[model samples]
Target: MGKATGFLEFDRLSEQNIPPHERVKNYKEFVLHLTDEEAKVQGARCMDCGIPFCNNGCPVNNIIPDWNDLVYRQNWEEAIKVLHSTNNFPEFTGRICPAPCEAACTLNINSDAVGIKSIEHAIIDKAWELGLVKPQVADKKTGKKIAIVGSGPAGLAAAQQLARAGHDVDLMEKNDRIGGLLRYGIPDFKMEKSHIDRRMEQMAAEGVNFLTNHNVGENIHPDDLIKDYDAVILSGGAEWPRDLPVPGRELDGVHFAMDFLPSQNKVVAGDKLSEQILATDKHVVVIGGGDTGSDCVGTSNRHGAKSVTQFELMPQPPEKENKSMVWPYWPLKLRTSSSHEEGCDRDWSVATKELIGDNGVVKELVASRVEWKDGKMAEIPNSEFRIKADLVLLAMGFVSPQQSILEKFGVDKDARGNVKADTEGKKAYFTSRDKVFAAGDMRRGQSLVVWAIREGRQCAHAVDEYLMGSTSLPR
Candidate 1:
């Protein structure tokens, strides 16, 4: 450790965010990254806690204490080296990851965590500014051709790793653009597309081929990739949004979060859609209280919705967690997102009963408060309510990967519909079909971006080992 007493001397500090009112006016990143000195002080707060549970908390197992020490010493160069040793994309995780690592922080047991994510944001941003992030051209070619379907974090990570290992990597994307959810599903205000763009450039320089508008099982055939490529890796994320099966689900003006989110992202990227869904002056009701629902709230506010309200079926969690009961693990607690702060009426323990429409367009919705007992839910009698809603957005989260591609590939699927594949032992990541593998949301169901990167890197190593009988790629 750089300073044994540093943790005692310094307090935890995090990145500052712009006021919600001002930030919601436009779809742009509002988080102010930590300055160099602020980051150093935050880094100094990492205790000499020998275990570093933050590593286990992080999906990629980042070397936290070492980098914290390096950053506290102002050794920026080596800090990034330690960072890149485990996680391939720090900037993405730094910005959007929920930072489970912080919850597992030793300091968090008593006080605030060390602001590790902000330090990572600083390190990666500084590395790029100093031109420390450069392409690693392979010194030798293994003559193996690999096709990675879906250009999300998982696919991108695997492609970069395999290409750097001297293999020919072809990244296939169904959309016109490269990034999957990063390019479409996520709102621009949360994270700009330029981050994904820069990483794509780095991967391309390392000999990975980017093939956009290539929808396997549709415009492109899964058999084609299987026949031409030496190995096939599936990273296509879960795209199946869980639907509300209540009455009037087919009414007009009701849509899925994926449909609503991607349209705005396309508009931001200069695409013109004649039939774009808009919340302008509409009474918007977002269903489900997850990140997607919050995103709907933010976007609706940006579009000048007359009113915004969000509903959650589950009971509201406590604002604070009992650390003693759930230390070093992700605890269940109430989380208020920036969008909620922007302006939203939030109701918990409520579930939608039905959507009502006039002239075939949804005009209102009925809901009822629920009570849970013995692991089962029962509606509270006479607790029914109604809310005006000119537009309804379903953000109840994804159920599984879209079955089309998986069906076309004849890949075995788990009970939840994700492509079935194991993560341990030799031939790990191998799908039921020979010469095929699966990872990320496609295999594990919907998850965070950090976990996707970890799965991608590990899957890449598995593929490399299967092909060349050895692998140097990190797990």
Candidate 2:
């Protein structure tokens, strides 16, 4: 609601990316954020929708209109306040989230949607530049202790909220670093690790205790945490990657996406590995067409792979979605990542048949074109083919949280092997065990970072109310 006629006055403007040729040379952020004027113009494009379906579309329920108005008025300070009121880490989402908010915008019915994500990115970048982001230490210490296992987005968000609520919170992680998959699975080009480091600094100032390399049920006993803390929240993300179990699956060149991704991250952090699974001068075939698959393609290209190809089992979706049919909801459509721009041959309706190799080393992959009718998939007759693939990365998404952690806690799991917990009612976020709760990908299975942040914030409120019978933390 910037100008009432602002939508007509200004057109949607998106953030620009560095050229693919130049960006592929380095593992750094290539997307250039909008200037203050560009961001203000973009923010002004938001129409004063009576319902504001953008809010409904956002998983964290961000106040889009309020912030858009604020940004248009040049209230950078107030814009960050509103943005952070709901999102604990706007910087994370601003960089990587697929903005569903824009899709639900009223202007999207015909014209381009407001650049909400770009404005968000601008607001946060300015906030950091002006040093507006600071730790909010609790005025009083409640003395009650809480243990949160995992260091992913959900765990980090919950720990921050609980710490600010006058509670002593212990954030534990098995990895040597804080961000679970964010630190490893994601490429540095999407978001620099410094963002996580800054949050860690602020959280430390807020009295959140972090324990790294504390793998529960192994080095650390789960019973100790349950016994010592007044409450426990599990936010360990889904880590068990969905793997292809076919002939020659045990080949040396066939590796999970997690294995390939984490190694690259470690190298970027200056960890010299004697042996690393490299894609240099080798043809690669990634099995999956999701974000993770795109990441594999990008990483392989940076490594100077001879060729890159990606396969999706389902048929290709349309480049544009029917807004009339899927308005205010996530729609199926073709998505090409920045990595795809670097260079990748993508195919749909193709399924990997088998890994062909010699001496237990993957050299090629056999596949078949598939056709889907109703809900069934069938291989097309006489459509078998083969492609050279020295490296194979299975990026078919995760199936469940690592069973070892969930099993050790003895928490009940839903049919999908996720931690059994309701999102509503009096028992919200409460697990089968007393004083035990779960959130994030561990509870909801694999999902977007924005969704994980929402679950974390809500779960924190639920925990706070359960302990104190009242809470001020926003859900």
Against the unseen true structure, what C-alpha lDDT does each candidate score? 0.93, 0.93
For 271-337, candidate 2 gives per-residue lDDT tens digits of 9999888899999999999999999999999999999999999899999999899987888999989
Tens digits of per-residue lDDT for model 1, 278-378: 99999999999998899899999999999999999999999999999999999999999888889999999998999999999999999999999998999
Note the residue pairs that clash in candidate 1: none
Which runs in model 2 stand beyond 4 Å of their true positions? Answer: none
| TM-score against truth, every candidate | 0.99, 0.99
Q: How far off is residue 4 in model 2, in Å?
A: 1.4
